[model samples]
Target chain A: MIEKTLKGKPAYWIWLAILGALIAIGWACYFRQYAFGLGLTGMSRDVSWGLYISQFTFLVGVAAGGLMLVLPYYIHNYKAFARITILGEFLAISALVMCLMFIMADLGQPLRGLNVIFFPTPHSMLFWDMCVLWGYLLLNVLCGWVILTAERKQVPPPKWIYIFVAISIPFAVSIHTVTAMLYCGLPGRHFWLSAIIAPRFLASAFAAGPSLILIACLVMRKYADFDAGKEAISKLTTIIMYAVIINTFFFLLEFFVGYYSEVPGHIHSLQYLFFGLEHNGEVYNNLVPFMWVATLFNFTGLGILAYMKIFKVFDYRLVGTAAVLIFLALWTDKGLGFVFAGFVPNPLEEVTEYIPTLNELGITIGVWATGFFLLTLLYKIAIGVEHEVEQ
Target chain B: MMDNKRRKFLKMAGATVLAGISAPAIVKLSSTDAVASGGGQEAAAGGHSQSAAGASSARIRLGMVVDMRVFYQDQALLDVAIEACVKAHNIPEIPDRKSEIKWIWKTGYENAFPEHSHNHRSQILEHNQFAVLCNHCDNPSCVKACPTKATFVVEKNGIVAMDFHRCIGCRFCMAACPFGARSFNWQDPRPFIKRYNPDFPTRMRGVVEKCNFCGERLALGLEPACVEACKGTGALVFGDLNDADSEIRKVLDEEFTIQRKPSAGTIPSVFYIV
Candidate 1:
């Protein structure tokens, strides 16, 4: 089963080589960060978190997005999803690995990260986030391995696997909820301190996670003799459409509250991200263009999906394009705008702009490469087993 | 037979659940006790004579009041107090403002009281340089956010303190702090220190540090370095807020004081009379 990943075509090997090289370069950059401190990054006292944490937050959503397929298949007994559920689980495993790596990159003392476990503070949301993330990762590995192996052997998975699946349904939700709480519980960070953050995180996760899977399915059908089935794809399209709508609505609710109340603390971050903020006759807003791009992509993606739903259009190409757009839109919104907004008007009311240094970008690229590398291997194994069973 | 097997499985499951739930609770209780005892030993080892005298008494809530009017009159007095604090604490003098670690710093009234500052505000209030430090809040968000108990409120004196050795420097405390009181040593602070106080210890790279309300000095029956330096100038006052006769409480009673982001509900011990 493990050797299945080694027996791929020339293109597969080339793709793996590219990811490996990127990972190597990323590690080289990370060692520099370790030798120096986070000072190597563009983060300052004002902007303590940078690209690393933002990526961590975004990937957690991507990881949680796996449940969009998991819940429908396992809980709803949707047989159409059985063909692709393993892919979702493997995607989660890869995303979570990247999430943990991103966290390690962000920590001031990466070696002492175990202190979080050794001296656990339940009061801190970070402690719970660690617990849930590790738990979710374990659940996915166990479930995916057992189910895929059973399929290869042409047997029904043991009844106990269903229990793990049930637990993972809520466990998946917990991972993103706890991640959101990491930001929301902080008192001073007005952008993240909203009760709506958890729901918004889930909505975006459901939208982006399945969209990634749809794109993966398309690639699998093209290259690996695996089809996620048209029924599964259409169901996912419906799920993405509704989830994207809910995500947009939740964001608008936040905008309404921030702008309508006109509280400086609540509005300042939003103003800085969307429109440039003017302080002491100096306009400081580097995020304006990124914010507008995300807004355009998100709504346009939503409009495309809504049109498909109304017209009952089942064109996979158009839906796939929309999925790609939605994926990028949420990725930018969560990974770029969301994290930066929380720290923009630093607690001292000083606007210290943050632009990621090349080193930071290198390290981030390395983490993403690592995730994709693992993802390719995991998908190879899963698709190999499915192909063997089909034969 | 089926009933017996079902009963056996249920009992086993319930017992496992009970054990799992109780295990963390027990550890939590014991750790809390450990922390309480550890605080006692710290005070004893540090030999805070004043705390020893009041060991059996009610917990003291230490507070500070800054008279911005005095600092406004003579900016040098503010610098004197800050210099004294930096010297007494061995705070690093990182030349780069991006990575600077500050125990106390000067900022304009607009930055200090951003919510209060509006367009067309008086020039005096706008231009006034106010000294801001950790408020040592009764409900400190930093202590609550610290995963390792590295930043905690002292049980004896209510001073928010840091155990630099234990800090993993996640900087969650920095984010949690509404007052921007905490600072992370982004690099080795030793080389950056222009004047190191041998009595005070310099922190390592990758640990957050902030104003500990001069907890070490108060332990030795002495005033905070900043308070002592500003004594004649009357710009800074430090006292037990719980004690009615303390100067901090007296000033609070006589003057209408404002706290930084009081609406945040941190119950900041530091007050200002603008």
Candidate 2:
């Protein structure tokens, strides 16, 4: 079964080689960061978390998003998802790997990462995050492999596999919720302290995760001779549509609470992000354009999705455009804006701007390449098995 | 044979579930109870005696109170105290503001207490500066956020301490701390040390550090380095908060004092009197 990945066309090898080159470049930069300490990155004492942490946060959502397919397919008995469930699980595995890599890359003492397990503090959300993340990854790997093997054999999966699927649903939800708790539980960061953060994280994750899958399916259809069926795609598009709506609504609720209340603590970060904040009459605003772009893309994508759904019209081009737009919108909102916004008006009541250095960006690209490489290999094996079963 | 295999699988699953349910409780009971009971005995013993040896043997809730009125009058006193702490801790002097590591530093009143300030506040209050450091809070958010107990509260004393060897440098503790007390060693601190203190060991790059309340000095039956330097000026007072008769307790009872961001519910042991 593993040999299927080796049987790909020249295009597949080229893709693998590109990803491998990016990963090698990333590791070379990482070693420089390791030698010089985190000083090589753009993080300051005031803005302690930069690209690495933001990526970790975004990827956690991507990892958890696999549950959207798993829940409807397994619990609700949606038969259309059977062909693509393995894809979702494999996507989750790759995303989790990236999440862990980003964390390691961010650490000042990367070698001592095992200390989280060696001396666990249950009080820490990070400890629980570590537990659930590893547990979820194991569950996905076990279920995906076992179920795929059974499919190859043309037999029903073992009864125990059902338990794994049942457990993974809640586990997926917990991973994102715990990641949100990492930010929300902090006292002084008004931008993240809201109770709505966990729900917002979930909504955005649901939208982003399925959108990535839709794109992947499109790629698979064109290149790998795999089709997840139109019905499956339509159902996923509906899920994405509602999720984007809920995510947008939740984001607006944050603005309303911040602006209407007019608490400086609550409004300061939003002011810095949306409308440049004035500090000592020296107006400094870097995030305004990025945040506006995020807002425009999200709402426009939402409108497109809603219009299509309401009219009972299925345009693949329109749907694909919406999926890409929504994915980028959420990525910008969660990955780029949210993490930095929390650090603005830092604990000292000073606004210190953070922009990632080239070194940091290089490492980030490497992590993404690593994820895509794993995703490609997994999909190749999954599609090959499915094609053989059909024959 | 098939039925027997199914029975075996079900039995194994039941056992796994049972173990999973009971593990947390068992861990909680053993770890918490042992540390709590042990800490209790030490605190009781430390309270009865004010001797330095006794303080070392038992738990002491080390706290500090700064008299801002006295502190603002003499700028030299603050400098001497800062100098002493840096020298004692082997803290590096990174000229770069972005990467500088500080155990204790001076901050303006407005920056220290943003939530408490008003537009109508007097110029005197606005202009006054106060020395700030780790609060060693009763409910430290940093300790809770640390995935590894690398940064942990000393059960024997109320000092929030760090194990640099164990720290993974995730900076979660830095985010959790409201006072901006913690600093990361962004680069190797050894090269930047102007005058190396052979008494204290310097930390490697990539770990979070802050004021340890001079835990090393305290262990050696000595007052904190800062307290020693600020002596006779009556600006800084360090004592055990657990003992009602201690100077820190008396200062709290007599003067109207305020802790930085008391609304944060961290219950900072450091207080300020203006």
By DockQ, the best candidate is 2
Task: Supply candidate 2's per-residue lDDT for B59.
Answer: 47
lDDT of 1 by residue, A1-391 (tens): 8989989899899999999999999999999999888888988899888899999999999999999999989888999999899989999999999999999998888888888988789999888999999999999999999999889899999999999999999999999999998899887789989999999999999998999999999887888888889899989989998999999999999889999998877788899989988987999889999889889988888888888889888887887788999999999899998998899888878988899999999999999999999999999999999888878
A161 Cα displacement, candidate 2 (Å) = 0.6
Q: lDDT score, residue B45, model 1? A: 30
Docking class of 1: medium
Tens-place lDDT per residue, model 1, B1-274, is 4234323433432332223223455433322322223232343233122433244455567788898889889889889999999998888888888899998999988888876778888777877789999999999998888888777776556778787767888888988999999898887889888887766667778889888777655543456789888866668877678867555677789999888988778899999989
Candidate 1 chain A, poorest ten consecutive residues by summed lDDT? A312-321
Give the C-alpha interface root-mean-square deviation per candidate.
1.0, 0.6
lDDT of 2 by residue, A4-54 (tens): 898988888998999999999999999999999999998989999998999
Query: Local error of candidate 2 at A78, Å?
Result: 0.8
Please give the distance, in angstroms, between residue B152's alpha carbon in candidate 2 and its true position after superposition: 1.5
Model 2 DockQ (Cα-based): 0.61
Candidate 2 Cα deviation (angstroms), residue A75 = 0.8
Error of 2 at A167 (Å): 0.6
Model 2 alpha-carbon drift over 4 Å, by segment: B1-59
